[model samples]
Target: MALDRRWPLALFRGAVPVALGLLLWVAVTGGEQERQQTLKGRRAADLTHERRHNELLMAALREAAETEDNVAHRPVPWRK
Candidate 1:
């Protein structure tokens, strides 16, 4: 009878800490997920800005190349 009565109390005591620990774990994981999402958004914005800059640079380079080709094909004054 004494052992049976003690078993319920012991089980309750053990379950309380386990339940609290699980709750704390969930809170920590949720915080980490929020931080990761914020970082991902910032990184995506940075990449978009970089892509736009690269496209502008590529256009400028193409224009310069065309100008260089035209200059090279011109007749030299001495040759004329």
Candidate 2:
């Protein structure tokens, strides 16, 4: 008896669907991983900005207090 001629065609049909499914899964998970990385980067940048703002605010307050203290210590030149 001759060998069947349809085996290759059947195999190809089954494999194409499996291969497509795997590719779809990879694409979806890769997008999610990229999104998570972007969120992490944004959070780090926000924290850095907030820290810098606090440092500048503290410096300004210290300078203002020093100025006030100097003015109070100065003598009134018009009086004796």
Candidate 3:
């Protein structure tokens, strides 16, 4: 008799796994939606100071590289 009635028990046992999987899926998607909303509310690099800062950094790097090249390939003052 027990062997013949196993199908119902198998179905009942499966219910918890299905519910947990759905719950995890909903939680992950809900968190992602909240994160997207937060990101949309604030724009990076939208302020004036940020652009000027980046421009200054690029100019400094360019000047440094030019100086290095000029000094590196110049004849050693006493070698030639």
Global lDDT of each model?
0.81, 0.82, 0.73
Could you give me the TM-score of model 2 versus the true structure? 0.44
lDDT digits (tens) for residues 30-72 of candidate 3: 7897788777665553556678899977875677677645544
What stretches of model 3 exceed 4 Å from their correct place?
Answer: 1-3, 41-50, 61-80
Candidate 2's C-alpha runs over 4 A off are 1-30, 69-80
Give one digit per residue, the lDDT tens place, for model 2 in 14-79.
Answer: 999999999999988978978999999999999999999999778756776776455435566622
- Please provide TM-scores, in order, for all candidate models, with all chains considered together: 0.45, 0.44, 0.50
How far in Å is the alpha carbon of 69 misplaced in model 1?
A: 9.4
Q: How well is each residue in 1-80 modelled by candidate 1, as lDDT tens digits?
A: 35678888999999999999999999888789789999999999999999999997787567767764554455675131
Candidate 1 pairs with clashing backbones: none
Which residue pairs come into collision in candidate 3?
none
